[model samples]
Target: CATGSAAVRQGIRAIDANAARIVLVVGAEQMTTTSGPEIGKNLLKASYLPEEGDTPAGFAGVFGQIAQAYFQRYGDQSDALAMIAAKNHRNGVDNPYAQMRKDFGYEFCRHESEKNPFVAGPLKRTDCSLVSDGAAALVLADTATALKMRRAVAFRANEHVQDFLPMSKRDILAFEGCEQAWNQALNKAGVTLDDLSFVETHDCFTIAELIEYEAMGLAKPGEGAKLALDGETAKDGRLPVNPSGGLKAKGHPIGATGVSMHVLSAMQLVGEAGGIQVPGAKLGGIFNMGGAAVANYVSILDRIR
Candidate 1:
């Protein structure tokens, strides 16, 4: 489930320990081949089955509940969520690998129509990530070996944090695990959020991206909506985010998402990202989570060669 980032972590550890000079990390998922009902059932297995097994919309239902709680405390964020979807969709248009590259405007995403009906809680279909099948791979090597390569993106920091699985055991909307992972990674990298040129975060759903804005210290809690509304996360804004469309449009091939995020960030760092490249990107941040923030991973990357 969390194997995407976990694989990267283990690969780095192996190299760090001098056990391996280079490690190949691969993540692939073939989710679209299955029937819809079976897909839902399989995804449900990622949840705390004892309590969330019967959730109506599978993982979407769980995130929907989180969205509902957030709205209750922060007022309705439908507009902000819609803006995020629209923004990501627009970004996806430039992503050659995106699953859905068509831009659906904010109005279409904000208002629920037959095409974007409510799937769970107040989350419309537009607010959810697509079921995608994709594969992404990375080759990690020691610093000396990496420097000799034509282009290299060095990991300044990488951190992983795990939290309780059951929603009852923790505050579902807080995303404490995500916050912790980001904090630890930044601290280890000896940098602050402002040092990042861009970020590629997990947007399993639009709400997840909204909350992640806060979890990553971009904004205060309950006020993450302002970042999107103010255009701070736009590709040309203060700090560009998800220039790759994130999971919202780039696709959430569950097993491959985390590695995909890292690959995209690395692309930006090395100036290899074509259409989705953030201008003058020197440092990049990446956050990838699994199971409603249960498994949190953060990485900071900078081009060394």
Candidate 2:
């Protein structure tokens, strides 16, 4: 992320920067074997693990618990959160590279399945995303540089936004800054949601997807779940999301995730995506979330030609 950001800063440096026209970003992770569970357990600890030896089974669970409390205190939506899990799992099936290619139906998810075990409260194993090894790369070029190329996609927009990582003293679910990032990104690109062909947001869990709907303004706060339940975020939706199956199905490799999101977005935008391609996508959006909803980066890309 810093690399891409630095490249942008350098590109705009002073006025006379290098003639570089392209920037490539890639994300890779390898978490095979039974170790996947243990590794995932550790990642969930980043949010709010009990430092005093409480050793909760999940960090996000702590957040989930907190979000639950927040909702109890400030209204919450359970249906919306479930949509997050269902959307990504369904999306993953089309992604041959995804770790968990098996898509569990909502009924199966609710009742539990052979592989879908319960993890944390309100967070079943199926509701969570995967930890797998994979890589995604992006080919970016400036508008002027891209126009000269026989094959290239336009760098329509790229904006970075930061959010409160430490959920300790803040409104956990009301991540307005995340919503702001989308506004800034779309504003810079001079387009609206109607202009976007598709979106690839972080779906670390069902709850994440639900919250993203609210954050991205796809739905009113807590209305994100409806998108999933109604299949509005599905492949055939007006605005298809996570055609690559997303992290839930595509696999999340931590540091590589952000880069991978951009890479996939570029692929879909350029019609390089095979089975996952939307009918007519001229523009795309990618939302990569990290470190307990603390860091969110959004990028917008369009076909250069």
Candidate 3:
């Protein structure tokens, strides 16, 4: 189901094992043709059907429950979630390939009207990523071969950690698997969170991004909201995040999201990102997960050429 990042991970493994000189990883999904109810039913299968099969709104409803839990533990973060939504939407305007290119201001995102009604739990329509149809591919080669290319982005480290599928087993809000994956990747790369120039994280829902700030060590648990409210994740902030507009604005085509993130990060490193470029970016981080952080993957990339 989350084969995008898994494909890249396996491709790199194959190269490391001398099984291949170059590998092409492609992720594609065509979902718009299906009926809304059918899409929801299909996506719901990714979750543990025994426990979450009846979740309202499918994946959105699952994340909505996570949002409610987060609000209860850390106090209401509705305003912060709205800020994230607005920020990503604003960033999307510059992305030529993004699904929604309009900048929805903070006020509009914060207050829901008929145009943006509540979807699941506390999440409004704007808070959830759009259902999209897309495809993205990237080529991975060994260091020696990549050096011969005109431009190359090397993978400093790539780590994947899977957690219990049933949300009933773990503290759903902690995203422990995500934290572990990030820590492992950064350690293997010999870098800290501060060393990253930018990040392209999975923002399937605004609440997910808010919690991810904490999981990725940008803030202490229950304090992630402050990062958004204080502009710490803005394009010009201390550590810019989601310069690609994230799934929140870029559109989440399920299978395509992970490879798309790597493609965009590679673009940023090579100065090909156009308006969404992070100035003087050297190292970029990517986080892509599936089924409420069950399949957590983190990659730290550096420009080698």
What range of 10 consecutive residues in model 3 has the weakest lDDT sum?
A: 1-10
Clashing pairs in 2: 27-256, 29-133, 44-59, 80-225, 84-206, 85-206, 91-245, 92-245, 154-304
Return the number of clashes found in candidate 2. 9
lDDT of 1 by residue, 1-305 (tens): 46799999999999989999999999999998899989889888878999999999898898899999999999999999999999999999999999999999899999989999999999999999999999999999999999999999999999999999998999888899999999999999999999999999988889999999999999999999999999899898898889998899989998899889889889888888999999889999999998989999999999999
Residue 273, candidate 2: C-alpha displacement in angstroms: 1.4
**Colliding residue pairs in candidate 3:** none
| Residue-pair clashes, model 3 | 0
Clashing pairs in 1: none
* TM-scores of all predicted structures: 0.98, 0.84, 0.99
Which one wins on lDDT? 3
Tell me the TM-score of model 2: 0.84
Which residue ranges in model 2 land beyond 4 Å of their true spot?
1-19, 33-55, 70-82
Q: Compute the lDDT of residue 98 as modeled in candidate 3.
A: 96
Whole-model alpha-carbon lDDT for candidate 2: 0.67
Tens-place lDDT digits, model 3, residues 1-305: 45799999999999999999999999999999999999899988879999999999998899999999999898999999999999999999999989999999999999889999999999999899998999999999999999999999999999999999999999988899999999999999999999999999999999999989999899999999999999889888888889889998889999999999999999999999999999999999999998898999999999999
Model 1: CA > 4 A from native = none
